[model samples]
Target chain A: MAERALEIRSESHTYPIYIAAGLRHQTADILKGLGKSTFSAVLIVTDETVGPLYAEEVAASFADEQPLYICTLAAGEQSKSMETYYELMTFALNCHLDRNSVIVALGGGVVGDAAGFAAATYMRGIDYVQMPTTLLAHDSSVGGKTGINHPLGKNLIGAFHPPAAVIYDTETLYTLPEKEWRSGLAEVIKHGWIQDPELLKVIKDQWLDLSAVPVDVLNDTIRQSIQVKAEIVQLDEREAGIRAFLNFGHTLGHAIEAEAGYGTLTHGEAVAIGMDFAMKLSGKVLGSSLDSEAYNEEMIRLGYDLTIPASCEPETLLAHMKRDKKAAEQKVRFVLLQEAGVPLVRPVEDDTILDLLKEEMTI
Target chain B: MAERALEIRSESHTYPIYIAAGLRHQTADILKGLGKSTFSAVLIVTDETVGPLYAEEVAASFADEQPLYICTLAAGEQSKSMETYYELMTFALNCHLDRNSVIVALGGGVVGDAAGFAAATYMRGIDYVQMPTTLLAHDSSVGGKTGINHPLGKNLIGAFHPPAAVIYDTETLYTLPEKEWRSGLAEVIKHGWIQDPELLKVIKDQWLDLSAVPVDVLNDTIRQSIQVKAEIVQLDEREAGIRAFLNFGHTLGHAIEAEAGYGTLTHGEAVAIGMDFAMKLSGKVLGSSLDSEAYNEEMIRLGYDLTIPASCEPETLLAHMKRDKKAAEQKVRFVLLQEAGVPLVRPVEDDTILDLLKEEMTI
Candidate 1:
């Protein structure tokens, strides 16, 4: 299959995202093309799960001139913590990595966030490339938002350090677990609901079993989702304006993830549920004309659990959402859809969210 | 003395610097004028020495609407490390400081670098105000260079995160220790050597006794130093080009400080020695006519120890210099002065640096 290349243009940096079946083996050639000779060392940050499987292959692609070091973290959301971040820094320092050193983040979003942040602060910022092994990383790889989670919340500490490049090898998806595929598909569905109704229609009509989707359709969908994210991020690199639209389901999604104690559910799983709540809230508040029943049918067919867990209390969830980074002036602000593709960020009262949560819990 | 305000215009942000004798007491008004109402909380990151003396007064300046919290680290260069940085992040999280929160860095360069770095990475970056209580902070507060020291080296990890505003209360300098006064003067003299020879002459002629300099003269000298720093930082916020000149003596200065152990010798003291070596090296290698005798005399009169300690080996110092962030491809780069106000960054051969260190040790 021909490689599909897309560019993300931001104020501080402009990088390319290459989507292909077997691009990880071409890491050296691609990096060399992006001025790799200046680098003296390469530190590959991956998770325990992904490291044993692919880190060596990626490391082999590098020329022997630049020595390679690998640092692996536990494969889960827990690794995206300040402890892990500091440990990565110490490992990089111990390896004698200098300013000219490059960090290759070769895993899913967790590894990307932790490693990218380490690169951002290591030596006051260094270059890093993203070799995403999971479908979820496609969205994260395009944006320069890299961070570690705080005990109080998710992604509470981070920096906007864009990757030097993103090499997305779709071939890795063949080995991805079924649950991981379901988790990643939620974000792809989110991209469609937030900004691309046409893409949403394509998914609804052609793809129901995410694991069985054809290669061409999967690549096309991922590229379209990334383009939507890239365009939004390009317009507002710092999330000062329209970029908040990308958080359509994240306000509640993050609250659920935090309340559920991260790892209890995947990021996409929580977001899928959040999207359901958002659609219901939009219909009641914004009088949005979204077809709720049809959307629910599609989600159910695609194997998404849209129900709020019994253990997650509505009050506690509401409290968690208030602490979200997107909150303003002590109010819970959410990104609600006006229709399928028309999204709006507005400050919603606590009582309204509480009522919606209570109502959604029963469903 | 009337409050003097200067604007630092950088491509990423434009913020004001407030310098006066007791501006710390007016923190609230100053912050309000700069749009403080938007903030939900304020985190004051100070040091043990400064916190006990002034944290309360600074905290009282804020309105009750925005809750205040204080986190203090030991008052020394040793506090500027990854360990301290992690502790501060944990404190901020415990206080529930959110995205709209602001961090007030209230101490010397150590607190500024550590606290500024925390703010830079917290929630992917937040606004931080520099309430510099030490003379050395005047140089550090304006440049937006924030980072923690690594065990391997001094300031080996950091970022270019400019503060929202700088509140330099000169009154705080009155209580500063004599050694600190001498330590900070090195940077002031460095400002003169790199960009303002007239200011250098002024310091030599009018302020031979740093402790005895009149308040008016001291304030004028600080503003002049800051102006030189501000102009260079404005042109290069990221240290990509001419901004490197700011590291006039930092390469060797950092090496000496690291070799001597963090708190054994102050930053400015080491830099003073570095300046002495750089001037001699300039005369020998660059064929620049720098008045080494006059420069050494001024340094001595200003109470700067211009000698390398016997315990710090030349080889170790040379090795540390090679690991400096400014070094490229194993070459040690120095900001050599062709003449006063005409600085150049050139790659110096390792052998040349080794010989200079050996010769300077005997001096």
Candidate 2:
């Protein structure tokens, strides 16, 4: 098969999200072309786990003339705190990194969020590259949604700072645990449900997939997923309008994650459960044609642990979701599916939501 | 005399800078019109001294239903620190301020810079009203150049955050110290030097006895000053190209300010001294036709302490100017006048600059 290089172009910026099997080895050549020589130093921001795995290989790629610094944080959702953000910024400042310097974010969503935000605010922003090492990063890394979590809200304190480039090395995915892969797939599934019905069919067909998928097919899927996010973001840079549609399952998912205390549930895992709950509610209340049996079978085949454990009470989850920044005046605003590829948001009443929870509890 | 309002309009935004005797009383009505608010809470951000003096009067004019909260900082350049920024933002977050929240910056340039930057970053930015109480703010407050000082540089970290409304109450200028009045006149002189040769004659004629000028004339002068500034800003939102003309005296002024430590030499005083030096250099090397003696006599008559003291050596000032972000590499760039109203930038050789300084010192 011929190797295909895909390009994602926007009105203000255009860069390629290179997705290939062994792209990590060619990082030096790729980055040298992207204006890295102007900088005197390069700082690598990674997680505790990922730092040991790929930090050495990535560090060696930078030219021997430029000094390098590696900053690593704990590997969890808790790492996206203000304390961590301040520490990372202090690290960069102490290193005497100037405006010409760049930060390399090399981890999952948490690392990307914190590091990207650090880059955004450090010296009023600087160039940073997204070296996404997780499946969820395929969404977070490409969209420039870099921010730290606020006590009042998740991803509340952030700016629309686009990355200089995104290098998605698929080889890194081999080290991800099954739970992490399942988490990443939830977002991929979300992109399909919101914008592309064909994506849903493809995923549904590959529900019980063998590990025999070609690199080109995986690359195409990542590109299409990115296009869905990029097109929405381009229309609404600040999430004032159309971009809010991207919060399909996140309205409930975030509430559950916050209530469960962040690290207790992986983002994708919570999102997977939220998508199921949203789909069920859609079928009962919003007249969605999604078949419950087919949906459950596909989720099971994809290895989602969708059991709503008794510890997370439906009332508590509902309350947290209502307190979501997206909610106005303590009302849960659900971005429901009118059909595959047709997403709409409306205020859902507490009573109906409670009844929906009661109906889903039987599962 | 009819109280004429000085209307200053920029692209995407418009507001009035009312300069008249006893116009502080007119704040309520003007704010209502500019804000389009019949009833909304106003977040008044002022310094420790300014808040006690005018926060009450400003708050009293609003409708009884309109709530007001004061966010106050110390009244100096030191208050523009990151700690004050965090405290002010935390106050707003605790106050339950929303997107509709209006921030009223009710102090001088330092207060405006700090408060305006706080407003710019809070909730990714909120609308602000500039009720400038100092003459220096006539220039800083109008141009939308809101930022705080870093230890390494002045105004290095900031964004182009234009205020929603600017109410320049000239009545407040009456309380300004004579030194401050001289300080602000430096910027007023700068605007004329950059864009209007006729304005220089106006300044040269009546600047010494500005204390006796009628409030209407003062209003007209301010209007002209703001028009020159607004026209320049309208063309260049960010300091990309032509806007650099605004830095005619700023390069030397900032270096002087930094060398003296920010608060010691009030911004205008340093710029006053810097402008005298620049004009002298312009006449020496660039063949400027303006008689250098006339420049010094006008400034002296206006109560300016134009001498660059022996303590702030020309060598130190030159080094600080070289560290300016505007400087490409280590070379010092100056905005010199080819003729009055025709400002142009060129690199001055270090030897010629040293020669000019040595000559000025001997005089």
Candidate with best lDDT: 1
Clashing pairs in 2: none
lDDT of 1 by residue, A257-290 (tens): 8788777888899999999899999988899988
Output the worst ten-in-a-row residue range by lDDT, candidate 1 chain B: B322-331
lDDT tens digits, residue span B177-248, model 2: 777877787889899888976777877765546555556666777778888888888787656578889888
Q: What is the lDDT of residue B81 in candidate 2?
A: 73
lDDT tens digits, residue span B282-307, model 1: 88789999999988887887777888
CA RMSD of all predictions: 2.8, 3.8
Q: Which ten residues in a row have the lowest lDDT in candidate 1 chain A?
A: A322-331
What candidate 1 gets wrong by more than 4 Å, as runs, is: A1-4, A35-37, A258-261, A313-316, A322-331, A349-363, B1-4, B35-37, B323-331, B349-360
Docking class of 2: acceptable
